[model samples]
Target: MSCLLEVTALCKTYRKQHGLFRQETIKALENISFQLHAGKTLAIVGETGSGKSTLAKVLVGIEQPDQGEIRLAGKVVTMTNYRKYNHVIRYLFQDAERALNPSQKIGDMLTDVLRFSTVLDNLQRQQKVLESLQQVGLMDEHIDFYPHMFSAGQQQRIALARALILDPKLLILDEALTVLDPTLRAQIVNLLLELQQQKGLAYLLISKNLRLVRHISDHCIVMQHGQVVESGPTEQLLTQPQHAHTRKLMGMS
Candidate 1:
């Protein structure tokens, strides 16, 4: 598969306040680089504060990297022009419920996304929204429900439906399954895999869960202190981790 997204020499830093008139420069990401191909899964596994979320933010245009190159479909992309990429590359957050509008119906949520992202009129948008709902195994009637009414898994499905509405070439799953139970997590994992096969969708999965990485990702990168210390095929990296941090993360140490 040809690469859909390529990131090179990515670096980001932040000024974190420690005390009055005292601020510390923290490196959120350092020379991070990776690529994702069509229909492939790339897992970013690391401990908290390891810059995994930072990387995701950069990719989705929420955070701008001070130094780096981000190329989508072999074209350069900067934060200024990033909104144009949203339809092709969508970002999904960890907290599914919070990602949705508490006051909005499911249909409204989906419709709102469609309205902002596409040129479809109301009748056309509604048809697409219903199609998206069905694609995620949601009934059309459930579209009238609110976020609080669905099960955790169904909420995720609703989010998934919204992400799929644009038929994005890539979906960035930033700790997206962290809140679910094991069974629901597994179900979402399977749903993601199935969606990849069905839609030729690529994924950048951000999580600390090695088991989730092993189950869904084709390739994996392990980060520590804002740098990638180890990376390879998911099974090999998990089974024979080369970096100490990777071993410790996999509980091998």
Candidate 2:
């Protein structure tokens, strides 16, 4: 598989207020670097505020990095040129319900993404929407329903559908599986694996779920205090972790 995404020394910081007049700078992501290949999964595991979410936001253009660059499909991308890459990188968040507008029909939500896509006509866009929905185990009838009309799993499936509509090369699964129950999570996991096989998607899975990480990731990276503590093949890292932080994550220390 080819390298689908690359990050080099990415850094981000925030000026957070400590009190009414005092302020402090927080290093959200520090010198982060990694590469992701097509049809692969990289798991990012850490406690809260580990910069996993910050990294995702940077990759998707929601936040700008303090330094470093991002490359997609071998092309340099920044905030200005990021829109060209939007169809290539999609983000599925933990809160599937909030990803949609309650008043909008599922069909409208799916089609709205095409407003930015110039290649597809009305008919092609509609077909693309239906095909994307089907890929996630949804149906045509779903397009007519509201966000409140589906179960959590089904709502997540719609979220996946929305992300897949543009046939992205990479997906930032930022705790996308956290909200579902065990059975539903397992089902979504299976669906994700199937989609990978079918579409050759590269996944950046950010989650605290060790079980899910072991099941779905080919590689794992442990993070703490905005820096990577350990990284290796998932099986090796999970079984014979090096860093104390990693061991702590695995409940070994």
lDDT of each: 0.91, 0.91
- Model 2: C-alpha RMSD to truth? 1.0
TM-score of each: 0.97, 0.97
CA RMSD (A), model 1 = 1.1
Across residues 39-80, which tens digit of lDDT does each residue of candidate 1 receive?
999999899999999998888888889999999999999877
**Clashes in each model (backbone N, CA, C under 3 Å)?**
0, 0
Model 1 CA deviation exceeding 4 Å by range: none
Which residue pairs come into collision in candidate 1?
Answer: none
lDDT, model 1: 0.91
In terms of TM-score, how similar is model 2 to the real structure? 0.97
